[model samples]
Target: MSEVQQARPTLLYVDDEDMARKYFARAVGSEYEVLLAASAEEAIATLATDGARIAVLVTDFRMPGRDGGELLREVAQLYPQIVRILVTAYADKDMLLQTVNSGEVFRILEKPLSVAQVREVLRLAGERHRERALRQHRLMAIDETLAFLAHELNTPLAAIANFARGIESRVAGEYTEQRQGEIGQAASAMHDNAQYCLAVLSSFLQSVRNSAGSKAARPEPGAEVSAGALVASLLDTYPFSGDQRQWVQVEMHGDFPVQTLPNCVALVLSSVMSNALRALAGTPSPALRFVVVAQPHLEIHISDNGPGIPPEVMERLLVDPVTTHASAGGSGLGMIFCNRVMQSFGGGIRIASASGAGTTVTLDFPSFKNRMIRSDR
Candidate 1:
């Protein structure tokens, strides 16, 4: 099976009836990884698969041994994240009432169920799963953001302090033009750091405000701004020293078509680029290439000739909702924000890196009607 198939949701159904188990498995097993359990005991055994694979659970209330209610209660304690469905006959009033009131079940399925009803329930269950996943992602993002923010704030604060003290020490000496230039650069870096902090704060505040609102608005297509222009503007605003700024080469390989896209999308792209710059800082060369290419789709590639990520780290970085690297100030928040933005925009971000070669991040945004990239030739 392909990687995508391996990532598909797994549904576990527990029922003592052979025919019911066979039929349900045949109906939904084509789309999902379906696991069958003839008794509650079998279901309990299946739950032992590290609880990482089971996405949903469907159990018959009146199983032969160790009934569904009992099994569900166990599942609730063990795998609370998995959506639970209680299947029962019409006459099982006591069990049905207990299942509904106990809160262990997400939804109850009546026996002799219509295929349409089953499909509808499964559809809603899938939505619930998505929402749960999103919430977990957001929480992880917040954690990573706070970590990165602390690191970002500290670097500049330390620089300002060190530079001021150094300048004071050299005030009485014959300060050369080079010395003066160095002082000025230090000051600029400190200022840029402050500005970056403010931008981050503003983004956080806006997110909070939007979350509190009843209706959230999504930007319409045809309004996409110039990705290159936006990156240039942000780079201009941020606290990059002259040396740091020089290493960041922004190239528009193809005329990047401008399509109306949501502002969050822009922020995501900016954050990833910003992180790339920071990551590149640790390298001896300190060079970063920001290439925006227009092809069948919009491809935003940010690469740096820094110490490339390790194989293990790269693997987790791609799949992890929240992951942090020691060099990136251990703030995994930028990646989470990038992933969330791409998902919302119907696009995706891919990261590639080798131990010594460097790292490249590619953001593929959805294509919409817009002016094509004009050829330079």
Candidate 2:
């Protein structure tokens, strides 16, 4: 398509009179591609087909079928991106008052539309649409950056803190069994988490720099690890407090090679474990189980017997970052991170929960035979 065909913003003009529609179209045909509708019903039908292309909707208030206010409300609900203009001959204070306060009308014009006035309003409406779209795009970018940073850096930073504390305790106490094994583990955890932190920061910096035109390079594929060994390594390195480890039960039915990024899998596991432990914090006989299946599909079930999510809260779990432990500095991106990581490798998560029935979260990875179907997207 040529510049003339694609550059002009679309305007949908609705009026009852045929002369008015033709006059309005002739007035603004040079700058805008105007679509005419004889009545509100025809306007809606036009919008239903070309809503995405429409940048502005100017409607006459006193129509035969539905009034302009009704059409404006419907347009606002269905196609909020379309800027709305109300045109009326009468100075009805009640209608104008309601329309103005409701934040639906962008601009109101008199019935006898002036050519200059229509052109200027359309230009201003197009500018407003562009500005609002830019603002929304920026807001979404900020949200995504925040979520990515929180999800990626959280586990390593937390592990570093816990491992440092363990090291401090060992140093303060005498050299015994605690110092023999605990100190080594703490030192290793510290080194590993510190390295992971550095890697995460470097990756984030590269991502920020290349966010616009350039695409970041795909990560190097990690070496395949058996499902059983991966779980063992995760449980051993995970930062667990006193008796928290005892509350967790692991049962591996069989072994299968998992080709997904080990670090990402570890990241997903860390988030799930954190959520499960938080849920079981105050419950009597709290049980957190990691059940692995290596048959048809490689599945890890993280089940916890704690108070299940409320209905209202559960509705927005995967959709938004909803948290129950916001007071404890919870980012509420655990499940979001888990789902994102799993889906990156042709897998997804299944959540089953009720008010008091506890919750079961299953990490559904591709089956062994279908492991090659991993997707980076």
**Using lDDT as the measure, which candidate wins?**
2
How many clashes would you count in candidate 1?
6
Worst 10-residue stretch by lDDT in candidate 2? Answer: 214-223
Model 2 pairs whose backbones collide: none
- The residue-by-residue lDDT of candidate 1 on 148-182, one tens digit each, is 66556656665665665566456545667778767
Lowest summed lDDT window (length 10), candidate 1: 368-377
Measured on C-alpha atoms, candidate 1 has an lDDT of 0.66
Expressed as tens digits, the lDDT of each residue in 1-377 for candidate 2 is 65554588889999999999999999999998999998989998897677767889999999887888888876765565678999999999888877876667899999688888988898899998887667646644663675478567867776776676667556644677666566766665565445434434443333333233321111112223556665676676655656888988999888665544444565566667767877887799889989889767788888999998888878888879888766555556767877988897788998888888888888888763342222100
Clash number for every model? 6, 0
Q: Candidate 2: list runs displaced more than 4 Å.
A: 1-6, 140-177, 180-282, 285-377
**TM-scores, one per candidate:** 0.42, 0.47
